[model samples]
Target: MVIPKMAQMVRCRIGYFTLKCSNRVVPRVFLPLKYQRLCFHTSWLLNVRGKEVLMPSLSPTMEAGTIVKWLKKEGEKIEPGDAIADIQTDKAVITMEYDDEGILAKIIIQEGAKDIKVGQLIALTVEPDEDWKSVELPSSTSIPSAASVSVSSESTESATPPPGQQNLAMPALSPTMTSGTIVKWLKKEGDEIEPGDAIADIQTDKAVMTFEIDDEGVLAKIISSEGSQVEVGQLIAIIVEKGMDWKNIVLPTTTAPVKSSAPAPSVSKPAATAAPAGLKPPSSGQVYGLAVKRLLEEYGLSSGQIKGTGRVNRLLKSDVLSYIQTNNVQKVKLEAVSPKTTKADAASRISAAAGKPSSYEDIPVSNIRAVIAKRLGESKSTIPHSYSTIDVKLDKLIDIRKKLKVENIKVSVNDFITKAVAHALLECPDINTLYQNGQIIRIPRVDISIAVATPTGLITPIVFDTVSKSLPEISETIKELAYKAKEGKLKPQEFQGGTFTISNLGMFGIKEFSAIINPPQTAILAVGSGREELDSSISPITRMTVTLSYDRRAISEDMAADFLAVLRAMLEEPTFLAVKRARNFMNQVE
Candidate 1:
């Protein structure tokens, strides 16, 4: 058949048939005959002399990303699988790779630029011999800017406000929350709700927080779906005033409401299109990406051999680097390396010629462990830490615990120690200060962080206003906090912003171990188990060693010593604690 002028045609011959295409590009053309199973492949390769490295979609819901760092600079010769840059998505910082081997000709976006949209040109790569200066970039109409993408993403819903309706928009739960996921809706449609009612539970970037309402109304309609991510200031639900015609009022079809500063009533629209299937995680035993697979092959390793630390146990480039550094393995030809060369074998071989397989397994660092490593590294490298240890007689505190137990009130030695530390902080306010922004901030209330060990890692839960709370109150609070912490349910406010931290390894029978100072806080006290010793009067005495790690920038050695001395006296003489309690009791009675 003849082709139209608007259509482009190409003809190819195979055996006795002629295959023709009108306008569409076909991969393989077939004939309608007895030999219909026979097909001919087409040679229609588009000329791709250069390629634009667009901002990649790192996560399923990642509309835009921030350039954390550039791994390859301009004029660098990059291979097909080389990492070009690191993109900071909503979930994590992932390395972006170059698909074609070329010379990085231009860097269009600088580092630290936020909200760069996917498919926006971030860099240009050209053949080694091609002059990139004459390359014509795509027009702005073809590829929208990052700002346009951001605006489009923000205004996915309708902008107009519904008549006479109250919109309950998603609030910025935390200072860092730009978007939040709806965990669950506490109040459903047609439910009568009053002021101070918790409408929903929102999972922000930091923690899950309750969304409370301040207006009295009937929950008319739910806008956003549960588990749907909604931007801050976007309408999530609608409420009607109590006196309005509740049953007869016709609700508008759900249209996603645009983000607004005020409570602009609007309907919800259909959710955004789901991300492509390529964004889904790989199946079990499969490598994460081409770059990761190449790196594994370069080192003659299998995907199952290296531990993955990425989300859902996906192996990342960082995990490979960590493995290489930890094992100190040299990259060799894949054919030269033995197939049975495990991580332990590599470590043992690096340490000594006699390959006594290293008795260690490579454990991928968890998210909490990685954060701990980074924060502790920063603290140790930047802050000047000075430690001092003091041994105090714990006989009085032990006797007090025994007496309290007999009164049907259970108390531990650590309880008295925490009380003593709080009292000493009150006496010496200088120790209760934080070195921040070139100033020593003296906290009015003594908020103490108690280190609790969980299965994942060590977490410190804070007890606020410790100086004012009674010993029993403090003991009960610590128990509650510890339980929540071990269950991984402690809120951000509970674990963050402490004036002091106490790490008691006494239960583990550890003796006098100094701890790294938790940042923003000047000092941390390390407590050891009590030991029995003979006193000068030949009587048995119980003593414990306490080591204080202080930031020299915030407090001097003399100040830290004086604070420890006061703490020692408070624990040694139980009378001070008794007198303080009696005075408070008498005031209450009066």
Candidate 2:
């Protein structure tokens, strides 16, 4: 497929694969002729000549990217985790890091090279022993054309850069983001913005992301106002080169509509081939996945029915919902589940349920809240979530907590649950894994991410090395993390990266509820409140419900059940925690 407006020449080896749709070419490492499913990867395959620095996917939505600048020139020695170049992704200009020690043999794509497809041969790296100067570019044997590939729209075209003016179109801040709400404009009209200067905080489907200016310019015009939901690539602001007249400049018109502007009466065309009701396809290219194709078939939506808002017209899951709302299309499952409804109808239902006014208030979704929604939806959709629940007698645990309270060593029930989970994971290591790039990584340390509810949304702050910390230490750490999460004072390391996650709604009196598994991690434990009940002895016994949601690909049913059983044993018998801690301490002493 010919990728339009992409001046960069993408060269790939014979065994490599390249998937192109709507001017978006995504390079793959599959054997020739392999098709059906697509998954994103960061590294390129290696050949006898050397490794190709295939353009790394900087963001989840990025199928293609631009090489903003190469930090290491050709022939420069690169260590593992070296930032080689800055890549312009759909989200931001992220520095691309190399993971292996090598000599930068040849640079295929240079700085300012735009629309370079992800996984395409951007550069070739040679081992330190090899001659970097003699290394040549990878073979330009273009990936053989796919026989049955979905094509990008023929009517789609790129907007040429007008003179020296920069059209600051709304970017896809997250993989699922089609349109973003301008939360606040950091750089106003007549303000000068340098490259990487924060321009505005954009409320994407995933989060409120700060959009940074990629080029130096004066804010000539701000088209989309604050709180306006602008679709990806829709002009929100205009930037002209440093000394341009910001006050008198006229705004340029584009095909993309300002979505959050005044709601006008929209009409769907009778012609099946006509464009989507009021949406514009975004970016320069697109990537269609298997799930999206299946959804299209399920919804009976043609390409023309819904405009994509992903990397260069890449269709997103949210786009399907947008189409359903736009056309008032009746869904197959919802017919039996509920009546067909529009936004107004849904709002009225909510109001009636809450005993509120007929007109409900529209709460602007913050970036953080969007993150939770997108993650929950994507986790439920992409991952085959399997569940295993265990009901553990909490009499022993409750007695221990009460006894500790008398000694001034008070610990919450969640602390005990968290500690018990750590012990259980250490025993059944198989369940403590992460599914990434189609690989199951069994993490050694037990870093548990505790889901904490804050004003913005539920944020998980990780408690690293939970297995090594004492119960008091664990309680202290959790309290600190929860406080930090609520205050928005969590550092990157404090919140990011974990092997397991625990979400407790026990405090809210929720008896039982399954939580969506966090990505990368294999499983999450949802803890419910403990309740007193008779357990065959005509005596009151406290029992707590805990459910484990796991990725079927990484964890089996047996694995999940065994993990829960171990967890139940540890929680039901409080001595197990002390014994496990002692054993660990003894091992360390040895």
Candidate 3:
């Protein structure tokens, strides 16, 4: 006998029966002569029904994703490598591919559905011959337990009711924060929270920062415990609407806390572990690991003397180096104890005899300041710098600027200087090269970095292809970039990598100053304020002193001098700035 088709039937067992009493077939006893078991696996039953396509974890730290767009529509044929949708994770928007070849039966979550948890049903796929209407979708409750469905750790932790539930996830504080450690919770469970309230202090890879809540609600539950390292976008707490009864709200079962990509030491544990035989751990307060400890020992440094920037005030290699650098500490070789001293000791003795400060306040460095310190320090120490100064008569340029102002075409002296410098770089290509890896890299394009001072620190936003942009265009671009720089909205590409740098202190009434070369660029020009002076003929002229600080490795003194001479000539002529069009200016410069 044939059995009726049942979709739920997973397995079937066949047995043989023999009857002995019945005369019709002479079957007396029922016995199992042979047995056959039919096993139906989900992978083998692919052609029979549609499979639910769950949201995939595109990134290691991605807990939920926003559907940016759908590439394929319902009933569309999909191949294994076809892109089905674009998912926006915490870090970036990435394309999602269809791993199984089938027809796109349905899209459960439409485009722009944000914060959709991983392993949640996103779409459905059915075999080409299978009827899409007849396919049954697994219930939301049973979706996680489906044979083909596998829940991610993030999904398991965030499987809460759709409405009236909000997840407070660990945010990506910076571009590099893969995970963050909970420093401390400001508000406990059942506390009413307002927008912009500091919920917790999180220690990221860079620094410890306060995590603020953007929504006004009651923090109903804290999912991740204090001191736990949680991945970016991982659920850290639960927040309910302000009027809702938080205690009555059913919380999802909390999963194990997500581990950070970076190994964070537990605060309660001992900072230093037992060293190998014949090696002793440093007597510092807390040294992070063997590498740091080894470096400290090698440098004959004490961890306590260096500020700890890692989690739980642990010493990091970078912190050690920064401390050593800031303190001007040097590694001294100890020989047999004799009263004989070296040059360094003599220098130290002279410095001690000169003066000794009783005390001073130690200020913690900001992120931008620290970066500036490190880069400037490195540039000053490594690069052999040479300076060239020229006092150019800027009376013509000043008159041109005044005439432009009358025409409502506002252009600053710096804009004219930038244009002239771009032209000068075209004429003197040797000054446009970069010295990197002991090789002179010829940069074909003239991308000039204009220094903008922000509240945090100094940043240089690049004016790309400066040789091709007109003065007014450069002026507008500089204004926009300066605004963005002050607001800290400048992207990495906007502020990084340039063939040359220009820093103008003219607005602050500064006369002449040398600027440190922003490597790997060959040179930087420092512009001072234009001061009125009388020539030998008693004619009034505005004179501005410009200093060129160049990397001696990439550019010779003569090459730098020629570039500045051309720049001064162009500025002094000032008619070159009249040609507002780049092509006309190029022709004029040539």
- For each of the candidates, the C-alpha root-mean-square deviation to the true structure, in angstroms, is 22.5, 13.1, 13.9
lDDT of 3 by residue, 472-499 (tens): 9999999999988776666544765688
What is the per-residue lDDT of model 1 for residues 1-590, given as tens digits with 9 covering 90 to 100?
A: 22345243323334233334565543454434454223222223221234678888875445677665688877788898899997776445679987788788777776545667778788878786555554434435234332322221222234454565666666644333456778799988898888899889886654456777766889887878797767655567778888775554444333443322222113233212211222323334843653456555554455555677644455665565566555544444444555467776677677677655566668955445656677889999988999999999987667666666665667678888888899999999999987766778887889899999876678788888888887778889999999887765676667756789999999999988999998778999999999999999999998899999999999999999999999999998865564443443332221
Q: What is the lDDT of candidate 2?
A: 0.69
Q: Which candidate number would show the highest lDDT if scored against the true structure?
A: 3
Candidate 1 at residue 365, lDDT? 52
Give the clashing residue pairs of candidate 3, or none: 19-27, 19-28, 20-27, 20-28, 20-29, 21-28
Among the numbered candidates, top TM-score falls to 2
Compute each candidate's TM-score over C-alphas.
Answer: 0.48, 0.57, 0.49
Counting clashing residue pairs in each candidate, in order, gives 6, 8, 6
Please state the error at residue 512 of candidate 3 in Å. 0.7
Clashes of 2: 8
Better of 1 and 2 by TM-score: 2
Q: How close is candidate 1 to the true structure, as a TM-score?
A: 0.48
